[model samples]
Target: MPLMSDGDEKVDGFFRLGTSSGRFNMFDRFASLGVKWTGAVNGRPEDEFGLAVVTASTSPDYRRSSAAQRTESVAEITYRAPLSPWLTVQPNLQYVHNPGADPTIRDAWVVGLRFAIGSRLID
Candidate 1:
């Protein structure tokens, strides 16, 4: 549930936890927490901005064989804007620490884009 809102502008926060059942999985535990803000941009209510942090722990069973680091963490920032009623574009940036949970690999900065398309079934 959203914690606060004023018209189309709002702030929301969330947390998630997950676990894998099998021993063969690369990750045994996952957790994330984040907050997002949505509001009018150029008088359009569809624009949104978000920031988040995430972490994952390597499974003990998998780590024993690979000698991998215990955990990986990431910090992310993103924005979403509408290109049209049915299309939207999102640009994202992330800093990954301990990429793949391997200390030998350098931390990395990643940039990416996402596109979303949707339509109503009955107009």
Candidate 2:
């Protein structure tokens, strides 16, 4: 996926004008595009399971802020496998990036896992 934006403007004192006729106004615009692929293998060397991959990107532009432009990207991977006849486990990992900011909450890597148990209750 791909995205693009282009515009021309002129500002005189407090008034602004666009290239055509409309007045230039301060606004924030954002655009995002992504792609994903998923498939399952009946029998393979790695594992007889499913696999998926997703990638996304975002671009944000602000005309009236100290931070004018910003970009971010993220990727996630998940794997599921049968532990036993009545148990299953899934693990996930993610990568993220944020440009222009302190290392507080936006720039980091995350990992997680999930487990499921299936059984019939006996009375």
Candidate 3:
């Protein structure tokens, strides 16, 4: 549940324990945690802004196969601004660490943009 929120604004999270590897998977017997926040931005309650962080660990299988890297992490920050009632534009930034549980592979930084449209149906 969202423990932090002011009406429309909310924060939520999750915890997971499982496997990520079997036939060439990255993490085996893996564990992960993630959090997400959804709220308004720039005094635009009708618009949207969000931030999320997620992290994971490599399982013993991965460790046995590759010991150099054992953890993975990613963070995403994004904002959406409304250009019309049904149209909006969003921009995003993301950083990743220990991608694919391979220390030899460099961590990554990414940026992107998205466009969205919403519709309401009446019957």
Candidate 4:
């Protein structure tokens, strides 16, 4: 929720955890933690900085049947900046370790860009 707030500036954190029965799900356990800061960059309230890590465990049944590794994890860093009131762009960098939980596969670095657009129907 709201971790800290100073006038129009703020910081927030989040966590997520999940589990499955291991019957039909590919992953039996999953977790993620993240934090975001607003208005911390050059006094731009619309700009945001974020960091997060996520991990998942392959279900026992699925690992046994598919010969998959036990776990996969990723760490990511990102920044979101607004181009206008209704449009924003986010650039992110990620390091994926044990992707798909396959030992034969190599860990990799990934870069991505995302664009978000929003508008008010009526105001």
Candidate 5:
């Protein structure tokens, strides 16, 4: 989805929604949004930042059978460093509220890092 951007796609965002028509799928519905902020960061014009949030609900049948089933949500934040044209490093944080949509399961906070290396395209 092309979104508002600064030349070279510096800032952009997206929205998503999903629903299942099947009776067996556990996910009855879900939605999420993701945003990216790139370039012009803290004097470093190449750094990138991202944020996302997701919410999902258990299927009607599952919720009816499980007393603890309910809607669940997760949010994440990340920062990416461009080491070169072909390499980038990203550190991300994630927080889940009511994992598994089961009230008995405590929420969790997770931290992670990701690396991206790709070949530069030559014209």
Candidate 6:
């Protein structure tokens, strides 16, 4: 996360653009943009089905007031099935990225869920 510039020492965890020694120079600036998409599908034995989709984006001017900027995006999906009248389960997944970073962040994941529980009281 070190900002780079000519004739300047690389400082750790510090970010700056178009500047030297915390001074505005208006010569070292950059911009960024991004987009994402997500989708999912599900079905059941009794003719039940489901679908979903999501999209997100970030602009370079979201935070930085100087000439430098960064952007990111993420997407997700989910599916479900019916095992019985009172019981059901679903799974979820996601993806993320940041195209303006050194590592170009990327990731994926999966999750599970359940529903319908019976409780008994004993005296």
Candidate 5 stretches with Cα past 4 Å from truth are 1-9, 121-123
- TM-score versus the correct structure, for each prediction: 0.89, 0.39, 0.68, 0.91, 0.83, 0.35
Model 4 TM-score (2 dp): 0.91
Q: Which ten residues in a row have the lowest lDDT in candidate 2?
A: 8-17
The CA lDDT of each predicted structure is 0.88, 0.41, 0.71, 0.91, 0.84, 0.35
Reference-based lDDT, residue 76, model 4: 98
RMSD after Cα superposition, model 3 = 3.5
- Candidate 2 stretches with Cα past 4 Å from truth are 1-69, 99-106, 118-123
Clashes of each: 0, 0, 0, 0, 0, 1
Put down candidate 3 lDDT per residue, 44-72, tens digits, no spaces: 65665666666777766657865657678
lDDT of 5 by residue, 3-111 (tens): 5666544777899999995278767899999988877466667887899999998888887777746688999999999887888899999999989898888999999
Tens digits of per-residue lDDT, candidate 4, 1-123, equal 789999768899999999999999888999999999998876688899999999999999998898788999999999999987778899999999999888889999999999988784234
Q: Residue 54 error for model 4, in Å?
A: 0.7
Candidates ranked, most accurate by TM-score first: 4, 1, 5, 3, 2, 6
Candidate 2 residue lDDT tens string, 5-72: 22221111111222221133222222333332222344322222222332222222222333422444
Task: Report the alpha-carbon TM-score of model 3 versus the true structure.
Answer: 0.68
Clashing pairs in 2: none
TM-score-best of 3 and 6: 3
Off by over 4 Å in 3: 5-24, 29-39, 120-123
Model 6, span 41-107: residue lDDT tens: 2222232222233322222343344332243333444444555555556565655444332233444
Q: What is candidate 3's local distance difference test score?
A: 0.71
lDDT of 1: 0.88
Better of 3 and 6 by lDDT: 3
lDDT score of residue 9 within candidate 5? 44
